[model samples]
Target: MASEFELIARHFTPVVSGSRTGVCLGVGDDCALLTPRAGQRLAISVDTSVVNVHFPADAPPEAIGHRALAVSLSDLAAMGAEARWCLMALAIADADDDWLASFARGFHELCAATGTTLVGGDVTRGELAIGVTVMGEVPSGQALTRDGARPGDVLAVTGALGAGAGGLALWQRGERDMAHPLLMRYLRPQPRLEAGRGLLDLASAAIDVSDGLLADLGHVLKASGVGARMEVDSVPMAAGLVEALGPDAARRAALGGGDDYELLVSLPPDAMDEAVRRLASQGLALTPIGRVTADPGLAGVGEIGPHGWQHFHGGAS
Candidate 1:
């Protein structure tokens, strides 16, 4: 078996941006040296995925790598930050060269696509797991937060919802076809970075949909000390989701499902047209799901029970 350092060098080292795009020093160092851009605030988040917990044990290595980093970046997107660097810690059962290479490729591919660099991380022997610490930067004073939402702001979401949950639902049914759109959604989720960046200074509050839509939206309401009214028909469903899960179940999936990774934002009513136009230019949809209200608690979307993934309780996210 190859030494631990050997695996790191072979799989991860080469992917670091020698160009130093906000990185002063990358791998092979005790601590990753980083430098934020002038007049910008650092936005950081960490996400951990465990086998049979976050994902199935038999999931593709490539998907595992992509999903881990993507989840953390989703947090950066929620803050309207540009993803810059990431550190990945992997705990694997054994030194499987092929799996490592494939995982690395998936991780590196996303890094390249998102302009993120692999700065530092670790590899160890244990049950299959991945922990990604992602860092990004946003202009000072322009970072969006959950507390900024006001009663009159319009609640919106980027792209569709329920796809991840729909995919997971399909996957849990013993479906192994990786190519299925729903399954791919569960495996590979695209973080809405561009839509988020464009919403800077426009969105009053923002959060990524990781836990189910309603569950995460409730988070925003709590932080902002406001309430919201969801337009049930306006909540976008994932392609073919209704056909697969039926209208009622699909509605529940969009409302109460988790792992979508889409940005749920509260934007000023005046900013709605611009926000819609900007995202539409990029071929991404920004739909109004509801409007923030002065009262506390959620209204509309009748009786959509128990949404999102809860780790302690084993719920879908």
Candidate 2:
């Protein structure tokens, strides 16, 4: 059995060696040290995933590792922050060497792809859980927030929705086709990092859709002291969602499914074309689904319904 330090040395330390950007000291230290660039503020967020709660106990270790950090990075994406550093803490029943190596591969793959450095973290014996604290740098006074939305702003989303939830549904049905788009969506969600940065100066406010679209949009509405009117027909559904779940169920899932990881942005109506054009250049779609209003609550037409993931209250649709 490998001790905790041995586990980290063999599987984690090597991967943390890239990028000396803002890291004063990284990994293998009493504490990771960092220095933000001039005129930049650090956007930090932490997310945790537990076995059988956030993911299936039998899920592939690689997928688990990727999701643990990916979820945390989504927060930075919402704030239009550039990835910089991350610290991970792991609790597992045993120090399984192969599992740890595979997990490290998955975790480091994203870090390398995004130019984020693994700073430091802890490992211990306990129930299966992974927590990650990710830090990113954003220009001072320019980070996006939920509260910046306003009346007459257009609400838009990057990419389609409901795929993650649809993937979960397929997995629950004992379908293990890894090649399936929806299935992979459940296992590996890509955070909209580049698209989010593109929206920094364009969007009045932004949030990543970890909860369902309607539910997460509500946060922006409340924070901005406004309401919304959505055209359900305009809300983009994940490719193959309608085929997998039918039009009605697919629409419902797109409305309330969690783990989408796409950015929901609010911007002025006139800026919609430019925002869409910018994301389109990056080969990503930005769809306008609704508009903010001066009213106090949400109102919608078509088959729009208010639903989303609320931890401990109700499971995701």
Candidate 3:
């Protein structure tokens, strides 16, 4: 087996060795040194995905790698920050060289696309999990937070809801082709970084829809000290969602199935049109599903049971 250093050097180091931008020091050091743009505040978040729990044990390495960075980057998106650098800590039972190469390919492709440089991380032997820490920047005092939502603010979401959950359902039903839109949505989540950043000045508050839409929006309402009423019909479904899962199941998935990395935001009712227009200009969709109400709990979509996935609660997203 190759030594840990050998593994990192072979698979990870070369990606960082050339063309240092905001990164002053790359993979060779104990800690990566990164520089943020002037007059900016740092936004950092970390996420870990475990085998079987977060994803199937036999899923492709590329998907796994893409997912690790994508989810962490989603956090930055929710805050309307610009992604700069990422660190990946990989724990595996064996040092499979081929797996490392493929995984690096996926991870680096995303980094390149998003202009994020990889700086530092670790490789260790363990139960097979990946942890990604993403660092981003936002103009001082301009960072979007969940607390800014007001009681009258209109609640909106980017893209479709339930695609992640719908994709997971398809996979559970033995669909493995990554080409399927649902599967790609589930396996290779595209963080809404562009939309998030564009909506920064417009959105009063924002949070990523990692958990179910209801659950995640519940968080925003809680933080903002507001309540909300959701129009279930206003919630947009993915293109193929209804046909694939049937109406009832699709409704359930859309309502509470989680794993959707779309951004949920609250803005003044007047700002809603601008937000929607901005997203459309960027070739993305923004939908108004509800309005902030008092306190927290489902209102417009009445008679709904418990929803969303929370770790350690035995719920799957």
Off by over 4 Å in 1: 1-5, 15-20, 305-317
TM-score to true structure, per model = 0.94, 0.94, 0.94
Q: Give per-residue CA lDDT, model 2, range 1-317, as digits (tens).
A: 36855876778886334246677778887998777788999899998888877777777788888888888899999999999989899888875778888888889998887888888898887898899999999999999999999899999999999987888878888988878999887788887889989999999999999878888998898898999999778999998899998987787778888788899999999889999999999899999999999997888754454643343114421
Off by over 4 Å in 2: 1-5, 15-19, 301-317
Instruction: After the best TM-score superposition of candidate 3, give how far the Cα of residue 146 lies from its true spot, in angstroms.
Output: 0.9
Instruction: Please tell me which model should have the higher lDDT, number 2 or number 3.
Output: 2
lDDT of 1 at 92: 80
Question: In the order shown, what is each candidate's alpha-carbon RMSD?
Answer: 2.1, 2.2, 2.1
Please, what are the lDDT tens digits per residue for candidate 1 over residues 1-317?
Answer: 35755875778887444445877788887998888888999999999988888888888889988998888889999999999999998888775678878888888888888989998898887898899999999999999898999988999998888887788788888888888877888799988888889999789999998887888898999999999888989999988798778887787778777888999999989999999999999899999999999998888867653343343125433
Would you list the clashing residue pairs of candidate 3?
227-293, 227-294, 228-293
What TM-score does prediction 1 earn?
0.94
The TM-score between candidate 2 and the true structure equals 0.94
lDDT, candidate 3, 1-317, per-residue tens: 46755875678876444444687788876788776788999999999989888877778888988888899999999999999988888888875678878888889889988878888888787898899999999999999999998888898889998887788889889998889988898889999899999998999999998878888887887788888888899998887899889998788777777788999999999988888999999888999998887666658877674443343125443
